[model samples]
Structure formats: structure tokens, C-alpha cells
Target: MNLPFNLSPWRTKLRLRSEAKAQVTARGSSRKKAPIKLGLPIFMMIVAVLCGLIMGLGSIQYAILIVAIIVAPLVLLMQSTTLIAWLLVVSMIVAGCLQYFARVEQAHWMPFLILAVMLARVPLDAMRAAKPGERSDGVDLLGFLLIAFVVLVFASALVNKNPPMQALVGVKQYVFPLALTAAVTLAVAPREFWLKVWRSIPWFLIAQLPLCLYQYLFVEKGTSTAFGATGIAWDAVVGSFGGNPEGGGASGALALFLCFGIASNLALLRSQQISPRLAWLSNAAAMASIFLAEVKVVVIFLPLALLILNRAKVLKSAVSAAAWLLATLAFVVGLLLVYQVLHYSNKQTGSKSLSEIFEFATKAEQDTYTYNRETGELSRTGALKTWSQENIGRGRLVESLVGYGPAASKGFSSMFGKGTVARKYVFQLQTSSASTVLWDLGVVGGGLVAAIFVLAFVRSLSLAKRLAADPPLSALAESCAVAIALTGSGYLYNNASVNVSSVQLLASLAIGMVFVLTRFAKKQAFLPAVSSQVKVVKRQVFRPRIGT
Candidate 1:
């Protein structure tokens, strides 16, 4: 057949691209034709506010719910991935303060609400135009992993007959962040948009310095006296991770953020992306905040994070190894010195050396396995111990498999008129995220969650290698890999995941970005192959017109 051109080879791609453009045009025209109406939305907002006021009698928690109801729909309608990214960042930085000021219980639900909206928009993504190779980007495995975990949560809840409200609260803490991977997988955008989102993280971290300083200097340390919170001092030096005015604040959460800040800055510094001066300044602020917060976990998590983030690069360069080693030593000594100085006035361990303090902390941690009936504080070890005693020791096979019920292991007092595992044991189950997952979701659910983390880390690491040509993106993917490791380790260290702490939120954002980049990497890989194939086709079709 004599043909003017061979269109068969590129027909599919061209057709898909044209169809995507048409879909976008149609959607835009439809929006212009039927502009959004404010009347019904305004009425809904009023109803939400009135319902909130009546439900909680003007309490802040209900007020937040009202805001969630009003904001979520509008955000979904706007359908700006950039706006969604910013909201996640802003909410992570300040949601704690909002919770503290409003005196709401649990991690601020606003971030979770925002995430839910992102997930809901996934279906609409099909209707929206997508870039080349975005329709399938190797994140299907990650998405399936997350969805399976969620299904496990629901199944466990149903099998154990968990209260609906209680089950939902548990799901929010355990499953929402994992769901973020699926949300971001389909919700793809330009690389610059994602980079801008990451660039804002440092500024937000710097903003916390002022708030931490104020809390340390002016606030009298104690537990929150807010309406629902009257326990640990959750306000002091918590930075934007707010709590009550007279309380100690979210020291654990803040410390986790500081640890990430230090690691991230160091990573950027190693990559030569930022000036050493700026990196040092940011690390100093984070270290100082760690001292003010007085969280000991940083001593462990920071070193591990640095090692994971820099090992590959450091191994290739002797200078990098030396620089990293020196920096690690400096951070360690500075952290210990600052922590010792802050606690010098306390009689118990004020005079102890860094070595002695470490020894004491180690011993105290090791001894926490046996429940302290006198204090009722459930340390991580204690939580695991107690879980084993009640389930394995007593041979409660059914309960061991599916758990007592969802939210059954939480520390909160029962809102429903029923006994919960936490209440029955009179121990704070929220102290250890690992134990909470084990006791609440049981064996199958916990395994699924672990699998999600493992798969996410593996995929991120692979993506990092694939994006080696793009240093910024490569570093970001490696950072996500490290974040996933830290987040999983957090289950052993504290209830960061169970409480929806800033660390978990930050890790979720990193994982989502990694998945988004996976799509980008796939697209990049496709173009080069397509170009070579097109050249081959041209050679075959127009080969040296023999007569010429």
C-alpha cells in the first residue's frame, strides 16, 4: 500500500493525548456554563455550624467538625492539586495549635478530613486530563497494599463488633495516612508543583522556632487544662504542635519534627542544594527545640535517619564520609549538652553525665515491661507485655486474631456505654503505636500495615535510583525512603502513628510525593524509548528510495 505517512506506530499515544485535551476543554466549558451557586452551600454552612453548636454545646471539637464540613466540599470542587498540597503542609504545621486553642481531643481531624477529600477526588481524576504515562505508573501495587490494609481495618472492626464511632476514630489514626498514597498516586501533577510543596517545609520548620521559644520562656509547664485534655503538659515548647497554655505541650511530636528537620537539612547540605550556613542555622534551631522539648527519642531516631539518608552518597566519597561523621558527632554532643543543661536544676538526674543519663534512660525503658499499677502509665514495653498477658497468656485466640474491637485499645475514656480493653486494664494503650495496632486490629491488620510500609519503602528506593539524573527528585525520593523507615520505627518508639502526630503526617506527605514522582519517572522512561522506536520506523518507511 502507498501511504503518505505511517500513523500506526504513534496512533494510540496521539489519540490518548487528544482525548485528554478534549475532556479538559469540555469540563472547563461545563464549569463556565454552570457556575457554582453559593446559596445552597451557604445554607449548608449555617446548618453545619448550628449542628456543631448543639452537638458539643459550642465546644471547639464540634466547631472543627463544622469547619471540616464547610471546607472539604469546597476544596474538592476547586480541584487544585497545588491547593491540596499546601493545605496538607499548612495543616501539619498548625493543626496542633488549632487543637490546643480549640481544646479539641485527638490529633486535629482537619488533616484527615483534607486527606479524605483527596481520596474522594481520585474517581474524578479519571474525568480530568492526565499527562503521558500517568494513567498507569507502577503505583498500582502500592495502592492495592493500602486498600488491603484498610479492608483489614474494617473487617477487624466488623468481626469484633466494634462501636461505629470508636472504629472510625481508630481508622483515622491507623489508616488515613496509608490511604494518602492511593490519593496521590492518581492525583498527579507537574514536578514543579510537588517541589514547591517540599520547599515550603523548611520555612514551616523555621516558623516553629519562635513559638517554641515563647512556650519555653513564658508558659508555666503543666498538663493541658483545656476542656477535653487535662493530662500531660501538652503546650510547653510544642511550637505549632499546640496544647494548653499552662501545659508542657506535644514534646514528643515536636521532637519528631525536629529530628526530621535536622535530617532533611543535613541531606540538602550533603547534596549541595542549600548553603552550609543555612543548613547549620536550621539544624541549630531544630537542636535547640529538641532541648526545650526534652524528648530523649531524638537521641536514637536522628542518628538512624542520617545513616539511612546519606549512606549511599557517603560511601562513594571519602570527603562526604568525613563531613557526615563530623556532623553526626557535633549533633550528638550538642544534643546531649543542651539536654543536660536544661535538666540541671532537676534533683533526680540534674548532675548526671551524658553517659549516665543514657544509662538511666536505657534502664528505665527496659524496666517498663511490668505494668506499674501505681502510676498507670503504659510505656511501649509495658503495652506489649500487657497485650501478651491478656491475649496469649489467657489463650484468647479469637481476640488475638481479630482483636477485642476497633478503638478497644485506645486510652480515651469511653464515649459509648461499654467497657473497652484500655478501660478494663486501666492502662494507656495509646502510648505505643505498635501495641495499639496489635491489640486493636490484631495479627492480620498489623501485618498488613507493616507490609504497606515495607512496600512503600522498597518502591521509593527503586524510584530514587530511577531518578538519579534528576538530583532534586532523587534526593526527595531517598528522603521519603528514610521517612518511611522512621515512621515504621516510630511504632516501636511511641504512639506517633496512633496519635496522628506531626511525624506521621510528615511521613505521609513524603510517601505521597514519592508515589507522584513514580508516575513522573515512568513518563520519562517512556519518552526516550518512543523516540528511538520512531527513528527506526522512519528508516523502514523511507529507506533510501532505491532509485535515488
Candidate 2:
């Protein structure tokens, strides 16, 4: 019925609309195919490689490092889960051995290898929006604290009186291990990697035990021992050999990290996720090794960790008084065991009894070594006393602001002989960690470090409480929290723990895992409920037939 003229007009309008749609589609496809901005990334990589060379690595080393950094992310993406999982264990084992292979200055470079591996992934993590069911990393408060810490450390080092070269050397070590937190938060993928990290803690401890045992016998044979406990009581780990344990007294102690293992094993045992027999056996063995280490700090703190971790059980209305009574009894028994071990060890080492040791610790002599013939080990006595005297005596600590500088205590080596207190104690005036902090970074820098530690401890406690209703998740948080809190021992008396190989590695790992676990817990909280029995599906990759 329509006229030819009206039909022609309708066909022309429809054809115009189809042309517009085609133009829009073409523009959209063009945008999608545009390449990522390579100009900036290529420039940045070049700058990084140059800086690596400037920092001290040779040209060959820089090339190797650059390649490793660039390739690490791709390696991570393509590698099977199991291989990635084992990297942490190997890293810590190698980290622990750093003390043997390199000097303290050289040891720190080892952690950056782990950092390079993590940094290569940052660009990828940022640009690639996470796929469903995939875990991705983002910046959090902990990362900020860490960055602030590094900056403060660097600033403090600049003001220090140590030789320019020495202070510069020390600053790098300060910055190195911090990379672990960044690495964990950014580079890690699925949850299983973290669990594997936790599992690796037990194995890491296991690997060290034989070395500790051999060192114990080495102490027994009157030979020089490696560090820490043997350096303290001479007979602390195994029993007294004829010779005294060697090294700076309180500086070399490992009580904090040994407590870490004890707390971790206890968390596993209480959660009951593992076989009952295995849990009990492993916990007992770990506790024994920790006790056998004979560090006084662990003796006190390990039981406290048990007490805090079990508060959930104790607070339950359904739980009876008998359970509470049993816990108290168990704690007392543990204390008694520690006491007996110390007593027997003291006798063989030619050290005075506990009462006499206390008398020496309590009394302040004129900054002299307190020798215990019975134990044959020299005591780093009056550490706090010396600090107090220095603070009250000259008011040096009061005036220190930016601090004398990192390793300022050792700065005196250039002016004074090596035997002076400044060189010997690694501080200008103070001997303890508090004094060291004041003498080194002063308040601005040291306060931030202190705050970081306090926040970590508080976060740990908070996370543990929040996750208490979920057993495995709760245990992971609580264990890590306990370990992180105890690492305050690094601030205990000297920089030994700070400079020591194992303590730094373990502390970095513990705090990193704590933050990582916090992220995991939040995600898991919103997930839908699933059955206890999961149906495992074998992944079958469908590659196209090349011939076809």
C-alpha cells in the first residue's frame, strides 16, 4: 500500500543506522588491541639496572640480576604450585646459612634475591585485574609502616658518626630483609603457598636441629660453638663441655626465635587439624628442642604463649574447672622442667646456681665481666644498669635526637681502640637495645621502629581473637602473632639479633605471614560454605591440534 518514495526513505535511514554501529565497533576493537605502554617500563628497567650497578654489583652481576627480576614473574606464572611452594623453605635455609658463608655485611644481600623475585611481579599484579577465584596483592598498612621504617633507617644512617663507608654498609642490611613483607604481599598467589610457608617453618627448625646438636657436642668437646645459647651458658643446649661458650654474652641469644617455633607447634597442636598422635608428638619434640636450647627468655615466654592461645577454651561456659586446673598444673610442670635443666646444666658449666646468677644480674659492679666459674661462661651483666648509669651519668641519651648514627657505638673504633666499651658494646654509651636505639636512630626513627613492633603485636592479638571460632585459620594467626611479638627480643640488649642471620630471616617471614594471613582470613570469611570433603578435579589442558 506504501508509495515507492516512502519505502526508499525508510531503507535509507536503516542503512545509515547500520553504518554508525559499524563505525563504533571498529573504534572499540582498535582500543582493545592497543599495546600496553612499553615506553615507560623499558625506561624504568634500564634505570633499575644502572642503579644496581651503582649500588655495587659488577656489570655482570647487574645483568644477571636484571634477567632474574624480569623472568621471575613469568616463571611464577608457568611453574606448578608445588615448586613455588618450596621456594620459601629453600630461601630460609639459605638465609640461615648466610652466617657461615658471608660476613654480616655480605649476609643481607641474600634476602634481596627474594625481593627481586617479588618485585618483578608488581607491574603484572597492578595491570592484570584479578580473575575470579584468583588471589592478588595490594598495598596495605603494613606495607606503609615498612616503607616508613626503611626511610627512617636510611635518614638515621646519614647522620651517624660511623665511617661513611661503614654506615652506608649498615644501612643496606637494615633495608634488605624488609623486602620479604613486600614480596609476600605482592608476589604470592593462592592460599596453599602460605600454608606451605607455615609448614616450611617446622622443616626449617628440623634442618637446624642437627646443626644445633652438632654444635652442642662441639660445646661438649670444649670446641668453639657457633652462636647464641652456646655463647651464653656453654652447656645450654647439650651440656657443658670443658670449654666456655664463646662470643658477646647477651648479644648472641636466640631465645626469641626458638620461642617462635615453640609457639607455632603449640598452635598446630591446639587446633587439632592434624592427626592427634602426630600433633602431640611434634609439639612435644618442638618443646623439648626449645627447652633444650636453654634460652631463659623462651622458658618464660613459651608457657605464656600457651596460656594466651588457650584462653578461648578456658573461657567457654561448657568447659569445666578441672580443665583450668589441669592447664595450671601443666604450666607449673613445664616451669619445673626448665628449672631442673638449668640447674643441671649450671653445675657442669661451672656457673653459680640460679640464686647466685640472680645476685650477679641484680647487683651493679663497675661495668666488669661477671665470671661464673661454675658455668665457665662470661655474663653480659648489668646491661640495663650500665644503660641507666650512662643515661643518668652524662645525659647523653637525653640529648640524642637523630642519634649518633647507625653503628655509632662502633664509630668510636676510628677514634678509640677496639677494646673500649663503645666498640665492645656496639653503642656510644648504652649497652641495652633501648640505649642502642636512642644512640643510633634517636626518637624520630627509633620511635617508628618501636611503633611498628607494637602494632604488629597488637594486630596479631586482634586477628587471633577474631579468628578464634575457625580452628585452622585461628591457629595460623595466633601462631604468627605469638612469633612476631616475641621478636621484640631483638630489641632486648644489643644489635646481635639484628645482625644475626637466622633471627632476621625468621622475623621477616613471621611478620610477612601474619599480614598475608590476615588478608586470606578476610577473603575466606565471605566465601560460601562448602562440604568437608572436596572433590578434586584433575586439570586437563586442551591444546589445539597443530596439524588441524
Candidate 3:
């Protein structure tokens, strides 16, 4: 067949080697050829702006349709979803600037923008990648449950005569990442790219430190600025999550993200997935951020998260034991310093001892969830009480079964009419994620959501063990499992998923990565030899190429 080149075996071997080298060179160059296509997103933005111009649809929100169209093709053509994932992460850090400084009306829609992309990308990728007559990425039990929850959301909205846009906005915060999980599960990317993305997360955590410090030192507590809402308590130290110029900041969310970062680095270190030095540095950054922010919840959430994700690997070696001990010591010392800061921040006229500070923190934590009957104070527990009684007490049996509607308990005032829930139970709007889910989706929907979380955590923990050889991937599954548990805990504390972009986006990504591992397992079962050969080729291609 190759007589035109050479008939001799040695000559043929030489020719084949050269061809293989050429192929490798071409493939490598192609990867470095150009960045993923941005035309799709750009074109969508143009269309959205034009729509706003023509229809007066408001520049802030051009609606979900425009963004969905843009996201589908980008995922299909891009070699990896890493860039898109980053687009979500990096944007979150500077979201405040876009919202306040730039006066971008819909800067808050960044998560939804990414969500639209993920939602569009998943179906498009699934359709494009699946072979004819091949098994589709069938909806699993969890998937079915998620779908049922979404159906309930929509059904509740329709039944209650809620505005479509209001319903969309209401449920977006809670469900956006779950939708993203579906996309990330099917979205393909190289292992190296995923690792790079994971490694960069710590740097993001570190980056928050500088801004946080500056805000803590220079920015007066009551001064309003682009960095964040200063008038609100602890708002001056809200890292990068900027808020209203009047008085708002995501100080709690910042604390949550930093605590999660600390937990992740600890988990990675315990498993030897990351080095001691890097893990220490990242944890230091996280602890420093927590100190500057002084959210008070970290002293509870961080330790709980660490305990839940604790692995047996930490006790297996002397070095691991030492690292864990040092980490614990660092956390304790950092917490003590944070308590000092918290005491000062309260503007106590009298000198307060360390014990007093501890007592204050404990009381504050209790007050957050405490319901006082005499004072009529609406804490998280109080909100839950109100929500449970809202539908059932009124004898609205059908409404109790499905809730008032989607977005029924959204915190912000809706442009759409102040419906029944908002009119009657407005105080419960800004409470915890659990109360909102219950208020909006009823018992059945909330139960389904809870089941989904439990199932995802169990499955991800199992997947982590199965992926023992791939440390980064295994760590990812473990991290996701921990994240799921933390998020469940968060439901009792705050609207972690709904209001906190970092928690929402990162948690979804981790869960999606777990499912991605599942998909990889499926692929391995079918094409084990192909993966091994591919790995070998990948190794060979990186060797020094003197000629090519």
C-alpha cells in the first residue's frame, strides 16, 4: 500500500514514525492555535442590546432566551468548558464593580448568564456527542427527582398565577447551579485543564485577602463605595462581593467561600493531593479573610465542615498528622484573633476580655436562629415557623401541597404585583434557604430537593473511592460531597445557594465533576484500551522533539 514511499521494513518504520510525529505536532499546535470562540456570546450580547433598544425591554434583562442561544454553540465548539467555568468564577470577584461602579443594570445576572450557558451547553453537547442507536445519557434517579422539583416549581407558579418573570427570578438563585451541574456532567475537558482550574481556586481565595484587608483598614464602616455597602455592619470587609451603594454586602457569603476554601485545601492536603506548603498558604489566606470579615458563623461552619470531610488518611502518616495538627492550631489562633476583631467591631464602650468575646459570639450565633415570642423578633427559626403556618393555617390545602408559587419568598420586591405570599408573609423572605424553598415549593418539592442532596453526597463519596488513582478527580468528588453537606447545613443558616454566587457556582461545579467521573467510568467500561493508548500517546507526545 505504501510502495510509493518505500518497500523495506526499516524504511517503512522510519516513515511511520515521522508521520506519527507530524500528527502529534499538528494536534499540539492546533490546541495552541486560538482561544475558544467568543463570537457566540458576543453576538448574543449584541442581539440583547438591540432588543433592548427596539422593544424597550430594559437593558438590565434581555431575558433568558438570548443567553441560552449564545451558550449552546460555545460549549459544542470549545475544546474545553474550563474557560466558561472561569468566566463565571472571575466575574463573581468583580461583580460588585460591574453592579455599582459601572452601573450595569443586570450585573447580578452573571450567574444566570453562566447558567443559561450551562443549560444550553448540556443538551447541545449530549445531542452532538451521542452516537446514533447508542445509549443516551439517560436521566438517573437523581435527575428525575430534580426534574420533578422543577416541575413543581413551574406548577406552583402556574397554579398561583404568578408572573413568569418573577417566577424565573425567584427560583434562579436556588436552582441555577443544579442546572449547571447537568451541563458540567456532560461537558468534556482535558484532565490537565480541570487540574489547573482546581489549583487556581486557592489563588482566587488569596486574591480576596488584599481587597479584604484594604476594606478593613481604609474603608470607614459607614462610608458607601464601589467595593461594598459600608453602612451595613461588617459590610466594609466583604472582599469582592460588592452590593448596593446604600447598604448591602455579602459578608456572610464571603466567609462561607473562604471557609469552603480552607476545607478544600485541608481535604486535599489530608489526601496528599496537594503539597503541605501550598495547602498551608491557601489556608492562611482563607483564615486571614475570615479574620478581616468577622462573619461570626465561620467559627461554627468551618470546624463543622472540616469535621464532616475528615478522612482516615490524615492519621495514616506522621507527616499527615503533623500537618493536620498545625492546621488545627493555625485555625484556632486565627479564630482567636478574629474574636478580638469581632469584639472591637461591636464598638463596646468597656474593655471586653477574650472570654467575653467568646460569649458574645455564642450569643450572636444563637440569636441568628432564635425566635423570641415576647420581642416578636423574626430570626431564621421564626421565619420557618411563619412559613409553615402561612399555607396550612389558612386551610389552603392545594397551596400547602405545592406552595404559593415559584419566587413566592424571594427577598427583593418584585416588579410583578406583590402577590399573596409577599403581601402576607414578607418578613420571611430574607430568612434561610430552607424556609424559602418550603414557602415557594411546598413540602413535596422541598423533600425532593433534600433527597437529591443526600443522594448526590452518597454517590459522590463512592465515586471518590473508585477514582483513587486520579487524585485531583477523587479530591473533586470528595470536595463536592463536602460541599453538598455544607450546603445542606447552610439551608438552616442563610440562602447560600440563592444569594451567594460563589457557593452556588462552585458547589454546582463540584457536583457536576462528580457526575463527570461517573461518565468517565462508563466510557472506560466501553473503551478501556482506547483510554490507555490515549494516555500513552499523551505521554509520548510531550517528549523533547528535536526536529518537529
TM-score of each: 0.79, 0.63, 0.74
- Model 1 per-residue lDDT at 413: 39
TM-score of 1: 0.79
List where candidate 1 sits over 4 angstroms from the true fold.
1-67, 80-83, 101-107, 126-139, 220-235, 245-247, 266-280, 313-330, 346-357, 368-375, 413-419, 538-548
The C-alpha stretches of model 3 lying farther than 4 A from their native spots are 1-83, 100-105, 220-232, 269-276, 313-337, 342-377, 414-420, 522-548
Compare candidates 1 and 2 on lDDT and give the better one. Answer: 1
RMSD, each candidate, Å?
A: 12.0, 16.4, 11.1
lDDT of 1: 0.70
Which candidate number would show the highest lDDT if scored against the true structure?
Answer: 1
Model 1 residue 444 CA deviation (Å) reads: 1.7
Q: Write candidate 2's Cα lDDT for 173-192 as tens digits.
A: 46655655555554446765
Report the C-alpha displacement of residue 285, candidate 2, in angstroms: 2.7
Pick out the ten consecutive residues of candidate 3 with the lowest summed lDDT: 226-235
Best by TM-score: 1
Quote the lDDT for 4 in model 1. Answer: 100
Model 3 agreement with the true structure over 286-376: per-residue lDDT tens digits: 8888877867677667866675567565767888878877887787777777666653544543545667767864675556456545433
